[model samples]
Target chain A: MNSLIRFIQRVSTTLLFLVLLFLSLWLYISTSYYQKAQFGRLALGLSGRLAERVSGIGQYIRMREANIGLRQENVALKNELEFLRSYITLSDDKTMRYSRLTLFDTLNYSYIMARVVNNTVNHQQNYITLNVGRCDGVEQGMGVVGHDGVVGVVLAASARYSVAISLLNTDFKVSARHRPTSTFGSLWWPGRSYTHVRLAEIPLHVALAVGDTVVTSGHSAIFPRDVPIGSIVGYEIAEGNAYSIDVRLFADFRSLDYVYVVRSADRSERLELEHNFSPNAND
Target chain B: MIKQLLRYLGLAVLLFALQLLVFNNINFHGYVAPYIYPMLLLVLPLSLKHWHLLIIGFACGLLMDVFMHTLGLHATAMLIVAYLRPFVTPSDTSRAYAPGMRMGFRWFLKYALLGILVHHTVLFILEAFTFNNLSITLLRIVLSTIASTLFILILEAMRVNGSER
Candidate 1:
């Protein structure tokens, strides 16, 4: 009995090492699904505060450009609102029966403004750090968009900070479609250029052109349908498979600052249907 | 003796701050950020018991994990390096250290590279975590390893120069 105790004592450090390793591995496994360390919440708060401070420093440098961008966005939103009002009034035809559908019945996308606190663009699987967290209504898998189009998806979050897996990353993939036909394909970077991504799994017969617009397919919870992702730049038929189209992204990540975090109101319901359709994809 | 301990502690804190605030923000050509914090583990007293080294290494890695928000990636890598240190040290052929002096820079570099590689491998694998594409995974690992080793080498040379001054 004494010898056993001695032997156990002799290897206790090694035993401890094994225990810690297992514990760490377990934490990692669970975090991949649900990282509940208030990371998102913390990240949001931290980035929000940082953005406020940094904006002060940047105000003098980029004042005129910021004003112009804001003015352009204001004009665009006003135009959209005017169009919506005219459509509502014009559709009041008594002969045309009411569909009993409201705008709320459609996919309603809400945007939460966030600041980029720590961003890395030049990485294989690059992640951008934002100054918004769970407390700021930021959550994992939320889509981020800038002035031009889709930026990335939120991967992890803390109390005041959040990390986004940028669309530029080779590991990032999303279901996208060309604007007019609504034909869908996978969007992924080819690791060769940040400005371009390869849209694969497209059928060879899908008519595409250099100036054709590509948009989100309303497939993932992260983005709504028709959110402009890019335009078809070029395409080629693979050795024995589908056509691979090259897409030029509208958002230049190097110059990104303010972004809108898209919150899908019906993400859970859509996800359930998606899971039922693609059981293997859930893993 | 107390001042020396205080200095090491300060260095550790400074490195961790730099890692979280500066180095992590620097992204050069996809996978080229330097990790200089492992130098603290590399230069720790060779005479210290293996158990103490493990504990110190674990703590150092935990510090990094806290800021990066990766719960255990750094900790696991650090423990591996610390556990393997004793076996590698005695075989290393560098300056014959008198009783109290630290291990020579060359020896430290050799030992630290092993630790850095182990850390980088674990980190890259954990980051990937899934078997999506074999070629991309291999490329990431190789690129990160090369960058990490270069960073470690530069830091070692800097340390030696600092000591000389």
Candidate 2:
């Protein structure tokens, strides 16, 4: 014990240096916004690879359940596709056909399939790491969605991996429309539950009911219009003249396995146009 | 020893206040903000124990981090400067090496300049956490280092003159 003390004293300087250095670096990387994202990008790539391998085993076990879900989704998509095809063919007027065509043509959105290698729902600012990245065209600021609904936005992307700020994060806010009322409000997680988010800025007079559907407003380029956000489950009068409505999200964040990164073809063009004209546009 | 401790405590508080309140807001073109608090570690009594210096450096940095909201950046840089202080200062054991005490102006300049450079480089680099903008980062480091060194030299000159009076 005496010899140990002497040894420690002999190298206390170096020991202290290493200990303090580690502590400071940990604090810096975890807290600072810029460093946190950079560190997340590097750390996510390594940890995401490990997670992907581990989840691979879990995926095999859940294959039957996943197959059932995929089949049901496929049937629903096929029905919707058939309906759209019939509607387009039945419309005889050229102006009506061209207007509908413009809707699909102007959207110009693409989806990149990715596996959710790592996910968290408990942290104040939770992040999900995907198995796809810049090489797969998953850039930062791209929107991410699950099979059920809206998921998150990509925060940083590396060569082989990308980290996204989950919808559960307090910092994440999305413009959402009340489907029944057509009223717009900002949807944000209140850090209470993963399944719940609060939709704010909805005026008090707007008729809100339980189970009323909510969706993306498409005011922002990150997400497309009508992407399911959640449905209203509860509400209360906010401090101001607005109603803060609680929404039950459709995406089961706890069971997330696969996701899609959304890329709008004209995102840059639209953003650049807004940047040039909008006086308050700040990147 | 107790008196020396109190003196440094007072100096630390003063420098912390000045750095947080004044120097931190003096950003020029969003690239340069002179950090003068490092002078606290630079001017510590040379004979102080190494472990004490390290602790003081860490605490000083942590305190700055808490105020500046740059959690570990300041602490890490300050700890490094503290560890490297002895190596850069004059090696003579017979005389005190406190700034302007017994060291020559040239020696003090070299010591302060090296310490500030080390502190600022570690700081800005850690804050950036990426080399993607190497040019901008280098520009910030060079500009901040010069500003900080100039501030330290001016403070040291004032201290020396105050003592003479």
Candidate 3:
């Protein structure tokens, strides 16, 4: 017993290191999947406020660039409004049940406006912090988009703040199809180049041209279909007869200031159907 | 003792604010972020208990993980470097330096860079979680190490020159 105690005392540093390594690995794997634990929520609540204040200071310095981003978004929104407006027909007849509801009456998705309090593009797995959360109708898996296009999906949220997995993150992939022929592929971050991502799994038979637009397939309940993602800039065929495409993203993640968190009201309904097919469908 | 602890705590909070607010927003392309928070562990006194160092490592990393939404990845890497730090560091018996005391330039650079290397290696590996692109991950580790270590050394030099508070 005495010898065991002596040995423990002699090598306690190394021992403590192993012990700590174990504890840390345990803690790491637990949160690797982004479970909304209490500690994460509390830490985010505290740091989110501080970051919000600090970023507010930088907001002044970049007001011009920020204004451009906002204006670009406004122009995009205006264009969308123009497109939607074109679809509406003026009917003075009494039988028309409520005029001016044609374009929006079938919208299964609603948007929650939020400001980007914090953002990053450097890490392999980057996350964006938003100034809105559960109380504001932001939830896990909600899609966030700027004026240009997709920003990311909500990872977790607190009462007043939320963190989202940026499209830059490797773990995040969006199903997209070329706008011309609707050839589908998956978009990946490529772990480098903030402005470009590699669109993988494109079959060689699918005709792809430079400047081809990539938009969401709407196959997943996370995001709506036909949402613009990026445009094809370059591509090369792999040895296995697959096209590795380089896409120029429309949304500038580095300068994200304002975004809208949107979720389909039918998301639950879609997932419920999958759940019937597979009990662990959500997982 | 309480005053010193308070000072250390204040520095931790300040560095964290700088990290989350300024550094987090600065990314030279992708996979090249300067991680300055681990410097808190690097500059601790040699005489401080190793267990205490481990605790601080976990806390610093956990704080970052919480804010960044990586869960426990940072904490794990922080713990690894903190545990290995004392072994790799030069022996400092009879020196009696304070925890945050500025060191000689050459020695400080070597020490900080070593710690940053160890920390970044573990961080990028775990962050990658899989050896999918070994080359890119290694490049990220090395580049981030240089960037973070250089930033820390400059910060330390400034502190040493400006009254060493």
Candidate 4:
């Protein structure tokens, strides 16, 4: 015991240094492919029940806002139905000809409702827990949107709960476009703010306005084309030839409570196309 | 002893819940974030066995990890912090020891800063594992360290005030 105490006293700092080095290395090695999807599902189930019970006490505080949201959603859905009616003949002909269709098959808007069970907003990479899971047809790679704008993508799902990778995370990347010209670029969070994202790799010639709309570019199957992401708050040209844009997100993260998980019906076929053309497509 | 254990357990629950729900939202200009949960680990008894301290700290961090969805960042940081805590703390047998002790601001500041530095360095590096932007990683370490220390000091002050006669 005396010898052990002496050893710890002598080498504790060095030992700690080594231990930290090892753990940091391990975290780096396993991060990209290390997904605990099943664990997330079970955790979601437990947290869902717990959040429900706890939130029940404060449900009254949120009732009014929720009601307002529902009424607005109803109005939006009605308008969407009216728009679809205007395009029903074209959609019918397109649907009959194309055996495989995508959610972006048309400019129509559809949504998958989900409740926020657990949420963390103050991390470099933040994730939200949703009550809808695989049982509710929620799947990985689907986009999650709030009433205002893009929330995140479904990273993992279990039977009763799923995990969303928020737009605020540094690890999250999306193909986005500016309105009017429809020029393409990538949208990513710099992990510095909840209200903005850094739009990368746009050419300097692409015209941009301070309040121009940023929407999903439809380059991927996760989100449909023209789903609102944010508005251009500002822009700066890098030392290189690219224009970096600052987008102010429409989602008020502090008041975020509900979301819609968007799944493309043709996810597998679109993935197949990208896989065939690309050298390393499996990621 | 059982009652005290229950009290601490309840406190742990409250800390974790509050940290996730309330405190996580209170980002002060994206530079400072309060880490009040570590107080649960900090206030643990001084006489605990070294291995036990390591285990408890691991569990404490694991709980936080489960909520944050980062598998091992907090666990790894907390373990090292726990292992090194006793040495950095004012030794009871040394000249710095004061009996019937209330650890003052200076001592708490030094101790908490050291621990936060260690924790944030490991965490930020782990998050930015690719060495993509070493400067940004360093910035995170400094910013998070300052934030956590501020949190620890504020909580300590509040505790001292409430307990003072």
Could you tell which candidate, 1 or 3, scores higher by TM-score?
A: 3
For model 4, residues B2-27, the per-residue Cα lDDT tens digits are 88578569768877876776666566
Model 2 residue runs over 4 Å out of place are A1-35, A94-99, A280-283, B1-165
Question: lDDT of each prediction vs. the true structure?
Answer: 0.70, 0.80, 0.81, 0.73
Please provide, for model 2 over B76-164, each residue's C-alpha lDDT reduced to its tens digit, 9 standing for 90 to 100. 99999988877766667567746553477788787788888899889877766667767777887888889888888888888778767
Q: Could you give the candidate ranking by TM-score, starting with the highest?
A: 3, 4, 1, 2
The C-alpha TM-scores of every prediction are 0.73, 0.59, 0.90, 0.80
The lDDT ranking, best first, is 3, 2, 4, 1
lDDT of 1 by residue, A1-283 (tens): 9999878865997887787777767765666422523343443454445544654565467557656666877898899989866766687774332342354457488999987666655445566778787889988889998767899888777666677878877557889987877888888986645688888887877777888999999867888778888888889997556888889988767656778899988887888888888859758
Tens digits of per-residue lDDT, candidate 2, A1-283, equal 9999878885877987899999988887766443456555655555567667766776777677667766876898899899998898799998998899898888788999998876666334557778998999998889998768899998788889888888987667889999998999999986556789999999999999999999999999999888998888999999899998999998878667778999999999998998989987764
Score residue B140 of candidate 1 by CA lDDT.
64
lDDT of 1 at A197: 86
Binned by DockQ into CAPRI classes (incorrect, acceptable, medium, high), candidate 2 is: incorrect
Q: Quote the positional error of residue A276 for candidate 4 in Å.
A: 4.8
Better of 3 and 4 by lDDT: 3
DockQ of each: 0.34, 0.13, 0.65, 0.32
- Model 4 bad stretches (over 4 Å): A1-5, A8-17, A33-42, A55-73, A87-110, A281-283, B1-10, B93-110, B117-165
Q: In candidate 4, residue A80 scores what lDDT?
A: 96
Clashing pairs in model 2, backbone N/Cα/C closer than 3 A: none
Across all candidates, the chain A TM-score values are 0.76, 0.86, 0.87, 0.82
Summarize candidate 3's per-residue lDDT along B1-165 as a digit string, tens digits. 788688678779878887888877777777688889888898776777777888889888877887776767888889888777778665675664543334456777787888889888988988888898899899899988999988898777765666544
